[model samples]
Target: MTDKMLKFVKIGQQTPPKRDVGDRKDDFNEIYDDFIKQKAEEQSSRCSQCGVPFCQVHCPLSNNIPDWLKLTAEGRLKEAYELSQSTNNMPEVCGRICPQDRLCEGNCVIEQSGHGTVTIGSMEKYITDNAWEKGWVKPIEVKFEKDQSVGVIGAGPAGLAAAEQLRKNGYKITVYDRYDRAGGLLIYGIPNFKLEKYVVERRTKLLKDGGIEFVHNFEVGKDATLDQLRKKT
Candidate 1:
């Protein structure tokens, strides 16, 4: 495990290549290219595999950073993806949006020791994105349906995550949002340059395929009161 690791001294740090400025100006899209499999494994090998993984310590989700990094370095990408998604609902989204410079990569022990930090975010993104491409990402499979139903307000990140977890436990979930389309901030608020709409759309589609219902353009105060909604659920 440590063989592939601790190569930060030799490998150096690298991120996925950026799109041309002219092309970026043409339309809104992700600026950075995805890291190729070889590059991802190489970058993952740069991890020090420190005794105390500050990367996971600083991460809000407390992901198993070192383990997944080792798995990635060892070319066990499916296992890497499984570990990455265990704690985080959307590793791909977090990889794109999370402020890694101030979190995981920021506190990297090697970076502090003068070697460049491992590209944790890019690795996370690559693992999940590759999983999606390989059909590894699938809908929630509930064993037994629950009698109680749950209504989640807002089709944003938090709401969607809650619905997914609840659905995994076999609860009937109905997400209510004010916007006509799902992904309130993701669909309407965030620019395509930062996070593409299709990424959010596909995630929404997965949730729908898992049987989580969405009632968009419905206001709690206008469409129905809290009491009425609670009673219906």
Candidate 2:
């Protein structure tokens, strides 16, 4: 297992290509081009497969970074995607927004020893993107319908993720948001350079497709009392 990894001595660090500064200033788009199959595999191969993976521990989400990296290196992209998605409700979103320089990649063992980190974030995105393209991503399927219904308070990542998990366990979930659109911060706050609105929209659509109901422009306090809402739920 370790043999397939630890190619850092043979391969230098490489990340997804970024648009030039001049082009970047012209419009709002993702700054970095995605890593192609070969480049992603090559970068993933740089992982040391250390006895202890600091990358996972340092991740706020505690993603199985090294395991997915090894799976990517071995060309097992589907397995890599499954492992990557196992720990994250929104792996693609985290892969884009999480500051890897301050977390997973920052704590990589090989990176501390002078070999550049394995480009973990880029690889994470690539795995999931590949999964989507291959139709490996599936709809939410509840085990059994629950007698109880739950109301979520926001439409941001936290609320969306919560709704997904709750729905999977057969709870009827209704997300209420203040804005006209769902995705509270994602739709209105973050700039497109770092995170695109369409990416967030695609996810919102998926949640709707998966049966998570959303009530936008809904002010809980003004529209209905917390106690009233609680009773309805």
The candidate that wins on lDDT is 1
Task: List, residue by residue over 166-189, the lDDT tens digit for candidate 1.
Answer: 999999999999999999888898
lDDT of 1 at 111: 87
Off by over 4 Å in 2: none
Clashes of 2: 0
Residue 168's C-alpha lDDT in candidate 1? 93
Clashes of each: 0, 0
**Index of the highest-TM-score prediction:** 1
True-structure lDDT of candidate 1: 0.93
| Model 2 lDDT per residue over 1-233, tens place | 57778899999998898999999999999899999998898899899887789999999888998889888989999999999988898788888888999999999998899988888888888898789889888878776889899999989889998999889888998999989998888889899998888778878888887888999889989998889998994
Give the TM-score comparing model 1 with the true structure, all chains together: 0.98
lDDT of each: 0.93, 0.88
Estimate the TM-score for candidate 2: 0.97
lDDT of model 1, residue 53: 96
